[model samples]
Target: MRRLLVTGGAGFIGSNFVYFWKKKCPADLVVVLDALTYAGNIANLDAMKNVPGFEFVHGDILDTKLVERIFTDQGIDTLVHFAAESHVDRSIHGPDAFVRTNVTGTLSLLNAAKAAWLDRGSGIPHRFHHVSTDEVYGTLGPDDPPFSEETPYAPNSPYAASKAGSDHLVRAFHKTYGLVTTTSNCSNNYGPFQFPEKLIPLCIANILDGKSLPVYGDGRQIRDWLYVDDHNRGIELILEKGQAGETYNIGGSNECMNIEIVRLICDLTDLRFRERASLSEKFPKALPAAGRASRELISHVRDRAGHDQRYAIDARKIKTALGYHPKESFEAGIQKTVDWYLDHENWWRALMDTLCFSKT
Candidate 1:
């Protein structure tokens, strides 16, 4: 059984991976290292608290000493790294954190993994799986084909650039040092426990609060959405049978415009709470004014700086090579995601209330 060190295990995608691992690889050991930043919450892993062989370390990926200690003490044989400053708007506002965490933090992990796994004479077969994004491939035209594993890196934002740098480091480590590594560049991910800043969750929360649903520009930017669970499954398959030193592109095969996604969320909300009783019972303080549909809350905001026009992934490589496929279509995935946020009102409400009180 493998002893896995999952960095950023408290974040959205990371936490989902932890749960997936528990179900798919229960016999293996999982050691989670997270800094518990604004995006990473300890509560994400609450369900796994009592599970055997699952350990959580409240720490940062930049802490070289702590990382090395875990590598040595836990005898970690697999590294699944998901920690990074991932918000594009935040990166545009302040690029320093993105550079530090996504670039420098990645370098630290690479060094520690190398020393513990390669430098030692124990001769253990280890794997370092680096999770990356398709944004590093840059924007696509309306007629352009989907991005493949061979796409050139042309990151447009600080966040994407930092990730691009990290991807390069992982590749270099494999080429120069012959480290057993596999990287997967996935498309946009949406599911439970996502921080409110992202598009889907933000829209959901805002609609519930009777607040404006801010849409950037025309909101026509296209993105390929991969439900979190599907993405996690793809990663698991890659880790199990994927060839070392190869990169795979994992996508949902579900591409929709931003405006379409927002409208769908609005419709789902309206359908679920068509009655006054349901609306009052759920939101209490944040009900839409009487007779007003949630779609009326849409507000066209200024476009994001250097936003990409479109992104699509050619995931045939993984599909053909590993027989991997996403189970959730956009229709099913969006409804399930909305249902989750609706049912977990207290969970997200606490976070929203804390932020509001802190601001005041």
Candidate 2:
């Protein structure tokens, strides 16, 4: 069994990956390292705390010493780098943090890996997999073909640019230092344990609180949505069968407009309220409780600066090379997302309160 070290394991996509990995490979020792940043919630992994072969360490990726120690102490042979400052607007307002975390922090990990695994001829069998996003390819025209592995870097936002820089670092380390490395750039992910700041979760939280649903621009921006577990499965395929020093794109092939997704969530939430009488008591301010439509709260807001119009991933490389294919469609994924938020009220409610997100 592999000894895996997953950074950012307390965050949204990372937490989902942790769960997916442990269930699929129960014999492996899984050590999670997270900074517990604003977006990283240790509570997300509460259920897995007592599970055998699972351990969590609260720390930062930039601390190269701590990372090296983990590599040596835990005998970590697989490094899944998911730590990053990921919000676009936050990156625009504070690019320094993004650069420090995404670019410099990635470099720190690479250095630590080289020291522990390669230095002094230790030569431990190791794999460093960097997780990235399709935003590094920049935007696409409505009719342009989806982003392929050969897509040139044209990152639009600070977050995307920082990620692109990190991707280049991973490639450089592999090429220059003979490090075994792989990178996967995934499409938009939505599913359980997602922080409410994102589009789908934000809309669900607002609908339940009877708050306005803010829509950016004309709300027609298109994005490919992959369920979080589906993306994690792709990662598993890469680790098992992928060649080192290669890049793979993972996507659901589910392209949808932003407004369309909001409306879908609205309809789904309304349906949930209708199906369950207890939900009305739990969330008294919910739109369905007042005989109001969730869409009625949709309000147009100013568009974000440097917002890319669309993003899509070709994902042919992974499917062909590693047999990676997302099984969940947008309808199935979003329905699961809606139902998750409905059933786990206390989880999101506590997270929202801690983050102090304005519901009004």
Q: Which portions of model 1 miss their true places by more than 4 Å?
A: 275-277, 285-289, 353-360
lDDT for each candidate structure? 0.90, 0.92
Output the lDDT of residue 354, model 2: 57
Candidate 2 residue 76 Cα shift, in angstroms, is 0.9
Q: For each candidate in turn, give its C-alpha RMSD to the true structure in angstroms.
A: 2.4, 1.4
Which 10 residues in a row give candidate 1 its minimum summed lDDT?
351-360
Top candidate when judged by lDDT against the true structure: 2
Deviation of model 2 at 295, angstroms:
0.5
User: How would you encode candidate 2's per-residue C-alpha lDDT over 211-301 as one tens digit per residue?
Assistant: 8988888999999999999999999999998899999999999999999998999999998889898889989998898777899989888
* lDDT of prediction 1: 0.90
Query: Over the stretch 47-115, how does candidate 1's per-residue lDDT look in tens digits?
Result: 999999999999989988899999999999999999989988888888999999999999999999898
